[model samples]
Target: MEWDWNFVRQIMPALVEGVKITILASVLGSILAAIVGLAIALARRSPHRLVSRSVGWFAEFIRGTPLLVQLYFIFYVLPDIGILLPPLVAGVIGLGLHYGTYTAEVYRAGIDNVPRGQWEAAKACNLSARQTWTHVIIPQAIPPMIPALANYFISMFKETPLLSAITVLELMNQAKIVANTYYRYLEPITLVGAFFLAISLIAVVLLRWLEQRYGRMEP
Candidate 1:
């Protein structure tokens, strides 16, 4: 079968636009995950066993569930309960919440790696609990967490295709639409694969650079 360069060239603009949505969703979702995950991680580390246990159980529940089911529940079920959201809103929330659970675990690992003496030293300096966490522990922990966070962003990018199931017009969804309309999968699908590979390669290079930068700052 001849690969139709003309079709690919013509649809490049559409493909690029769709890729923009893919990037936006992933970036925004990662930001949400970072913020929410930090909170959840801290909650799970609280001195109060009830707070810790509840947060831990919620994180575990989210991690255990299928992302598709979560998406369906948020996008479909919530509307029936009168908490309607736009498709994009639902998609972002679902993706953010799902990955936030994983990011919370990453935060836990990084925070746990901080030396025990660091906490003692902060308290010796008369730092309050909030001050210790904000000024000491998180500052030390966040650098190591950046690489893992970047990797999660890449994972979220790949998962953006799932948003299409909820009717979000992300890259894969747009490609599928084009294919259905034109009765041609070759150009649209190939272009979509190439687009994803290119972006993923860029993300890998960026992550490596960040890891190097953070590694130098850590010690």
Candidate 2:
């Protein structure tokens, strides 16, 4: 079928709304993933064997599962247990949690890469664990981790389409609705691909900048 500029104009508004929701979900979900991942990484490093082992198992379980299944449970199954989250909220949590496990691995690797001498020095200085973490380890570890974390967040942004399965109405969902309604698959689907391509290109550039900036470690 021929492309219809008129039809494109008509659907731009709805698609724009979808774009907003998509960005909102990606941003919120990325923030949550970062926080949750850091917590999981720290928990896994706990001195207590039970706490560390249990947390490690939980993170592994989350990483092992499909995000689509996790989304279903968050949006559908949780309501059965009186945990009735709105569609968008559930989608954000689902994205956050599923990706948080992966991000936890990134955090774990970043933290582990810190020099053993740094830990020894902190101990020599009589620094408390909190002070050592806050002042030294995090400062060193986080810089190198920034690029990896950004890459994961970018992947999460691309995965926003999965939110449609849970009825969150992101870009892919909007495109599908438009296609089904007008029975014209070309315009909407193509436009969604263009939008994602443009955004991914921009993200790649930003990722390069992050790699140049924070990817370098200071001695």
Listed in order, each prediction's TM-score against the native is 0.95, 0.97
Q: Model 1, stretches more than 4 Å misplaced?
A: 216-219
lDDT of 2 by residue, 1-219 (tens): 999999999999988888899999999999999999999999999999999999889988898889999999999999898999999999999989988998999889999999999999999999999999999898888889999999999999999999999989899999999999989999999999988899889999999999999888762
The TM-score between candidate 1 and the true structure equals 0.95
Global lDDT of model 2: 0.92
Candidate 2 C-alpha RMSD relative to the actual structure: 1.0
lDDT of each: 0.89, 0.92
Model 2 alpha-carbon drift over 4 Å, by segment = none
Q: Weakest 10 consecutive residues, lDDT, candidate 1? A: 210-219
RMSD of each: 1.3, 1.0
Query: Candidate 2, clashing residue pairs?
Result: none
